[model samples]
Target: EFLENYFLGIFTCEAILKIIALGFLLQPGAYLRNVWNLLDFTVVITGYITVFAQTGTGIDLRTLRAVRVLRPLKLVSGIPSLQVVLKSLIKAMAPLLQIGLLVLFGIVVLAIVGLEFY
Candidate 1:
């Protein structure tokens, strides 16, 4: 818990510095145009909500903890190759789903054929 809190603090401070450097509301366009900025904002907000909800409401927010796991994705935004790969995966998801269904249908047909042979 202590390590997690430490890293969260680091990320929170980093996000704050980024917002300040970006001039915050003064240049919203510069800040929002990059997908990485969006990710940073999301992770920071989720972190704050997790901390506040845990302390203020006296309730465990497990879901917010899960959201915090997205911190590693920050690294993804730093790498050009990873960004291309991530984009490709996102763009391919629909076709991949269709391929998966086709494979499943083939498996079912093979199973039926085997049963008949038995």
Candidate 2:
């Protein structure tokens, strides 16, 4: 199992590297930023197929929960779309976060006043 998994990893890495080399060498798809996301999707789908193939119609909800826990991996795996999305969300929410903190303080103050008055 270890050897098979190791070889599969090497094969996938080599294939992805070849495609990236070709992209650079041929200057293809320069406009798209999430080009590498396709590779991540391919790898993840391949993993799911392998697991299902080995187990034969028996995947529990707990197993699925663990799998879904990796949902953020779609963003964290250096895929450009996810990276840019997280960046944009942070940028957009910075001021909102600050405002939320102020709101929280106001709520705390109001709660204290109500407690003291009542």
Candidate 3:
């Protein structure tokens, strides 16, 4: 399944475009370099449109259980600032976890000591 998706989407498109891009690359050079990138954009847009156009020829909201998750993750790829913020949040959460564990251990130790005195 992974191989099928890879060949269909990226690898196949890249292989074919590399052949065409070769001509432009050798002559007009990197200024005309953006053609390959545009081909990539075209392939991706066509793929997504084709997926939704399948079956009933329109996107079925009932079958899109994962759209909400997909939308945010896809958008996050374009946001370096958001990625940095998320990284900071994960790091900040580490001390909270350690403090929670230590507080829990302290409560257990105190409970044991109080019980001994009683």
- What are the models' TM-scores? 0.77, 0.40, 0.35
lDDT of each: 0.81, 0.60, 0.56
The true-versus-predicted C-alpha distance at residue 103 of model 3, in Å, is 1.1
Question: Whose lDDT is higher: candidate 1's or candidate 2's?
Answer: 1
TM-score of 3: 0.35
lDDT score of residue 8 within candidate 1: 77
TM-score of 2: 0.40
C-alpha RMSD by candidate, in order? 2.4, 9.4, 11.2
Name the regions of candidate 1 deviating beyond 4 angstroms: 25-28, 116-118
**TM-score: which candidate is best?**
1
Tens digit of per-residue lDDT, candidate 1, span 30-82: 55567887887788788878878877898888988898678888778778899
lDDT string for model 3 (80-116, tens) is 8876886689799989999999999999999999999
